[model samples]
Target: MNYENKSFSIKSWAEDDRPREKLLLKGKSALSDAELIAILIGSGSRSESAVDLSKRILNSIDNNINKLGKLSVLDLQKFKGIGEAKAISIITAIELGRRRRLEGALELSKIASSQEVFNIMQPIIGELQHEEFWIIYLNNSNKVLLKEQSSKGGLTGTLVDVRLVFKKAIELFSTGIILCHNHPSGKLQPSNADKLITSKLKSAGDTLDIKVLDHLIITENAYFSFADENLM
Candidate 1:
């Protein structure tokens, strides 16, 4: 054992200061979101501290942890020294945290009203740069069955997969679903394609005994609910 060779590993912080060690000693409640992220990031670039980078990221979103998770991969790339691999690592970690949070609360049928949909969606919706379609499957009692991602796409937008959407409904034994997507354009108004696709999905739902409750278009600061305005 060459004792002199152990000087320059990434874990320069003392055991008390190490995020994981602190968590072990003090429990998870002792760690802030940035501290947790610093643990994930492991180390910083030459001049920046991992905690500082995490703080900068959090501050960019007005100190909202949930909001930062939704930031686009491209948007994250804007930070200096964050290359593609690091960007993916950051995005994937946030996504896993979200899914973990949703694991116990993904009851579809219990949720009602566009506001409920908005609340569940704000995290995923806020960070998107392009369009993404999510299907909120609800049981006969309107309790959430599951939240499944239907599709993702570019400026032209996601193509709704009617067959796959129904497949998930069948798996969850859902009686209804809510269609949700984001408008990167910041205009909550549904596009012509948006309208056309909604009509198609609604018609399909009718045939399959699955109801189409609403289609919500969320923006950076606003949202539109089809059911709220009787669009569906």
Candidate 2:
């Protein structure tokens, strides 16, 4: 075989420079994102090593892993040397990473106060451009049973049903519930609708023997707590 015709492979590279080898020697965290992707791809075209191709692929998406994770198999196959198998490998890895994140969040099952609730939710809903309503169910000890999104709507408003909220709390055997939502406009002040909903949910919770712990209005930079303000 002509030397020029030989495709580049990770095995031919120096041990420390090869993705798999480097991973073994320095540990997985020591590898770059492209190196990790290259290990997944396994091979590359005649002109490029897997690492080079992986770098090119990431660059195409501006190195944004979230955008790359959203790619379909067909979309990935548009790149050279990335066929059906490689595309599947990439997508499967991305999905696993996403699941791990959700699992980590679930592991943080206990919450103590409104500020703790804010810390947990700030990252999830703080950056959204629209309104979202969430209910967190807690046991008697304030251990979080589940966090559920109750409603999502446009920039101006979101509709949340009180019945659905209590139903979920009852199903979870929760003793307390925390209500939360975001104001995309970065206004922390609660609207009249906000006041009315807070009153309605609190009343319903009381009748059902479930305590309404707090209602928080969140924004990108600030938050308002109804309980802290003596409105609850």
Candidate 3:
């Protein structure tokens, strides 16, 4: 029989022929996003199948294979089969379900210990894609007043300026500052450059009469505190 003569109706096909029935008979993990979406879309136009359209969309996203976040309606409106209404439905539906992880830095509790501050900060800045240095400005009572990204780029002993630290501390009226940075490698071990930079900041803080409380090395999973180890 010629392939062109074959029937295309999904109902006329076998139990194994349908994506939905295959998922029900097997399990959900066995189905690709395209297969799953084919079920939601029901059927396709004469020119294209539902599965194909879904494949195009999933592929356009670089096959992320996870829940789509920030896949804007505007981004999807450019796709062939997806109109504004469909794109809006998808984006709004996804956003409604997302309870974004809030690593609360705005809590009223004053950070008493270096370790306590390290724990709170580890979740936010530790897992960043790029190297960024942050300063936590502390009030006279050692409570956090402002958290700001001090610099953005590679961190070396000579690259960081102590003036920037004092400038920010003065602007925030902070009596002390906690310096922190993330290790893209997740090592949590301070380098020779890190030590040199800290020593310079300590001297500057002494001259400026602003306390340099601690320097923290943050990794995605953990943190190393200079004060905790008596390095500060």
Candidate 4:
């Protein structure tokens, strides 16, 4: 029970008691948060095992992973054995976990209206500092077949290739397509360039027999819909 004087290594422990072996035998979900962090950190200072050091680090944040995520490398270095590499390992793991949660939470398969499209795509692109053009390809039931980034550009504008948009629609056998892009300036009003592109894409969609559902100009707080404005 006196751990301060012992320089324990995880590999010296029983196989079932080791973080890596336990994970392989019982699955990652069976490991505690500190155990996972132990695997990332790999080693500890002369006085502790990696798991003990990890537990101390986690306890310093009161087991709040959110607070731990906000920690810089310098902040993590306050822990006796956590160096820059170990700090980056913990930070990268936290980031990947955050993105995985977003992937699960952001599913909107059905495209019912411009509002629904806005709800689905807004969280992904609305607050961006640059322009990004996205296409939502839909099946006959208006269920989304796929969503893809068609183009990315500077703060002012993005160049969306009409041919590339329709090509993806054809490949997916999509019956309807929704066009979307963000305005970094937070302006909901569509510009002349916006109207021109909408007209051009609508015309192309008509020839291919794929319905152009709408073109949406999105901002963090609001959006302008070409279909709602009778521009489509």
RMSD of each: 6.5, 4.9, 7.7, 7.5
CA lDDT of each prediction against the hidden true structure = 0.81, 0.89, 0.72, 0.87
What residue runs in model 4 are displaced by over 4 Å at the alpha carbon?
1-105
- Per-model TM-score versus the true fold: 0.59, 0.70, 0.57, 0.58
Task: lDDT winner between 1 and 2, please give it.
Answer: 2
Best by TM-score: 2
The lDDT leader among the candidates is: 2
List the candidate numbers ranked by TM-score, top first: 2, 1, 4, 3
Report the lDDT tens digits of candidate 4 across residue range 1-232.
Answer: 6667676888789999899999999999999989999999999877788999999998988988766766888999888899999999998997787567547545766777888888778767876789999998999999988889999999999998999999989999999999999999989898888888888999999999999999999987689998998888
Query: Which has the better lDDT: candidate 2, or candidate 3?
Result: 2
For model 2, the superposed segments whose C-alpha errors exceed 4 Å read 1-6, 113-134, 149-158, 170-173, 180-232
Worst 10 residues of 2 by lDDT: 98-107
Candidate 2 CA-lDDT value: 0.89
lDDT score, candidate 3, position 89? 61
Which window of ten consecutive residues has the lowest lDDT sum in model 3?
A: 96-105
Tens digits of per-residue lDDT for model 1, 1-232? 6645544333786888778889999999999887887777676676676777778888888988667776777988787656677778888987887777445444443786888788688667645788899999888888876777899988558898888888888888889999999887788788999999899999999999999999999876678999999999
Q: Estimate, for each residue in 175-201, the C-alpha lDDT of model 3 and write its tens digit.
A: 998888888776878989788888888
Better of 1 and 3 by TM-score: 1
How much RMSD separates candidate 3 from the native structure? 7.7
